[model samples]
Target: MSEFADRIRPHAPTRDDASARRWIYVPYDRLTDATGPLTEQPASQTGIVMMEALAKAHRRPYHKKKLALILASQRHFALKQARRGIKIIYEFTPGIFADGLEQATRHHRLSALTMMQPAEREMSLDVEEARVRGIPLQLVEDTTWCSTESDFDSVFAPTTKHFLMDRFYRRMRQKTGILMQPNGEPIGGKYSYDAENRRPYRGQPPVPERPRFHPDSITQEALHLVAREFPSHFGTLDGFDLPVTQAQADEAWSFALEHLLPHFGPFEDAMAHNEPDLFHSRLSALINISRLLPRRLIDDVARAAHSERIPLASAEGFIRQILGWREFMRHLHRRTDGYRQLPGQRNNSSSDDPYAGAEPSALNAHRPLPAAFWGRRSGLHCLDTVIDQVWREGWSHHITRLMVLSNLSTLLGVSPRALTDWFWIAYIDAYDWVVEPNVLGMSTFADNGLTATKPYVSGAAYIHRMSDYCGHCRYNPRKATGDASCPFTSLYWSFLDRNADNLSSNPRMSMPYVTLRKKPASELNELRKRAAQAIEELCHAQQASPQE
Candidate 1:
């Protein structure tokens, strides 16, 4: 019934078949059990050190509650696999986990080992290492996500056309034939009801709810271990109701259906200052784990929509998160194969600049950006300020994350690496596949032309259009050119001017830059002065923060 049974069905090595059975073991953070190779491979705990070092670099303990969440999850998976009659050995390494995989094989007498594709850097490292050693290796489909690699590659390989999400989405519909009629046609004369999904709550609609679950003994034990081991972590564990088992995860998913899915489509991108869970189905963590599969999740959502148990938009949106975005990320990450080296991936690209030279490179790679890249806890410092706040909450709406944090990161040149890693470490929902592409490629432009046709760089006006943040903040989102001017206004112009050779030559940016140049001389001078002054204040602020 499980993917493991299928992979090793006829080839399973038993005592009758061989005198000794050894394997390469990987403990997944999401799945309940540990997995091993039917072949020979060595294993270690280096992933623990990398996890610990990441926290230490950020001045948070390796045992911090957030870090603890991952460690606890992985540890539990290892134990589960062991109970199910699999071999697992743990080791510690500071660099990539794949290096440990390689080392384990070298040290062992076994022929070769099997492993899962790691969540971050070192996927290729493991595969290549296996090849170099002339050892047989098995690459398994990560059952955590529903789509297989072949599914995405096949869909993408057909035409020489540029990838469009909508096209792939349509094909997925035809293949699964979800919400379609028996005649192989779509329901309601349309495949998408996106237009009906976008209503800003005027407080008139009934307030939808998120499923609430009490942690059972297993999750409770994990919570206690996290608190005890990482006393200095950033988040509070008082409200620890995270789903840890498949049954519990199913309950959590069902709860999303009953309480949240109806409204998810409309407010999916909306954000409120203190509202962390606005019409969101927060099952990414479990989805990343093996307890749930995206295909099944998508199928369930389609059923809900066809049955009219939920609105089409809400169901469609949910499916996109699981089926579209999550699946695309896996393929993108695997295809890129340049995860760690990408600019600003593990650290801010800004940190590599001379001004940020003395900053700890490793720290910058993994930790949040220095607060100074923003304002004095005031204006230009929006992304850092917003992210620091989010670290405590472990959640925020998509708009808040993108428009406020990701947009600000791009405008501030926070560097793709640092921003991407921050998104990866801070969000409970983050996995390498999703976080890297969104943060590195979409948010920060670290991956160049990988995901987006262009970087999503924007200023305060976009923020104001989407949310109420501008009204509550001190900076003037409107005033374009002076000390009182919103930092985004001047900084935005400055970015365009500075990168004109790189940006304006483009076909898409010509109009916006032309518009900026149309400003009067006096206004342009004011914009320059305001932007420069803001940078100075920011530099001073960075100098004042405590270093790790």
Candidate 2:
């Protein structure tokens, strides 16, 4: 037996006389699958294992709310299982996940181990480790996801090129018969209502307040453990009210369908001060943890739309997020091998810097991420507001994440890996499989256009038009070089100019290239100088005050 197996000590078993032959390892993310192997075998013949691997928690200094949610939800699920007359072994250890699993198997004297295939590669690696140590581990299909790996492969295998999300989304709609007419066409004569979903909130109908759940004693205990262990982590525990049970999750879902779904379409992209979740369903954390399943949620939304309880646009928009983007991202992550290519691979020889010849300097991708990312004020209204909300709530809607945080980071040329790490550590819904494809592929265009047809970079003009962030900002969105010039505006021109060689030939970027060429050499030089100065100042501020 391994050294880790020596730490085998069962804290709680459902029954002392139960003869357990198989152990089911229940990861925190798959907390709701009670019908799997747990139900296949007799309760007395089965054992469920839940672990609090402290080393894994400390990997990247996750947000306090994220930590609380995962731990609390896992503990609650374990207790729920215990009440169901199922044998369970809960392990709290400072060692790794594999060690915890090995300990559980040995402590219970189990003959076989079975687990639902984990969504994350890291968790999968732990299972592989156990198998190598002579433990018989059976990997079952993870029923949490709406689509399986085979489903993704079946659609993309016939095509040689990179898979586009829109095409895949249409396939999913057809496959699932969601939002479809009786004749097998999309409802409302179109597959997407994205154009209808961009209307800004002018404070007309008023945004409804979302329901909040108070933490019970079990959740409070989980909060205390996280606070004691990760005192210095990002985010706060003050407003930690995420749902930890299936009933609580169902109530939250019902609340969204009733009050928020009506306006969810039009104002989905809009952002305002003090509005962290404008008409958006704050269900990602719950869905991620299996408190709410994706297929059930999609079916509920579709039924509501069909019955005229919600608008077709609203239902389609919500469905697209889950069925289209979320599913597409997972498939893309698996397809691209998590986008593990070098930064320069996408740049062509014609687009390379004249000074650097045929190769772009690796230094372009090595810039350190600034402290403003961790809630420090950058004196930029939009950035400060978004970061502050993340520090307090561990979440922000997709638009702010894409347009404000990600767009600015791309303009500043922050290392893609650094930004990816920050997002994974900061968000309550973040998992490696999701964050990597989003931050590197769509948000930053760091994979150069693998997922996005064009980079999502924009000047302050787009920001000012889409949001109320510019109303109170000190910088002028119109200016690109003055003292009060918006950093986004300056960097916008500079980003286009600096990468002109690489981007000029792309047909989608032709208009931006034409505008870049229209600018005088002096103006272009000035924009570059101003952009460099702004980045330097931001970096200096971060160094001076490491914490906000």
Cα RMSD of all models vs. native, in order, equals: 7.9, 5.5
Winner by lDDT:
2
Lowest summed lDDT across 10 adjacent residues in model 2 is found at 354-363
| lDDT, residue 317, candidate 2 | 95
What digit string (tens of lDDT, one per residue) describes model 2 on residues 333-396?
A: 6665455432336442243322111222222554667778865668899999998888888999
Question: How far out, in Å, is residue 316 in model 2?
Answer: 0.8
What candidate 1 gets wrong by more than 4 Å, as runs, is 1-26, 30-63, 74-119, 123-137, 155-163, 179-199, 204-239, 339-376, 379-385, 505-511, 543-548
lDDT of 1 by residue, 483-516 (tens): 6667777877876776676667667777888998
TM-score of each: 0.74, 0.91
RMSD of candidate 2 to true structure, Å: 5.5
Q: Which 10 consecutive positions of candidate 1 have the poorest summed lDDT?
A: 44-53
| Shift of residue 401 alpha carbon in model 1, Å | 2.2
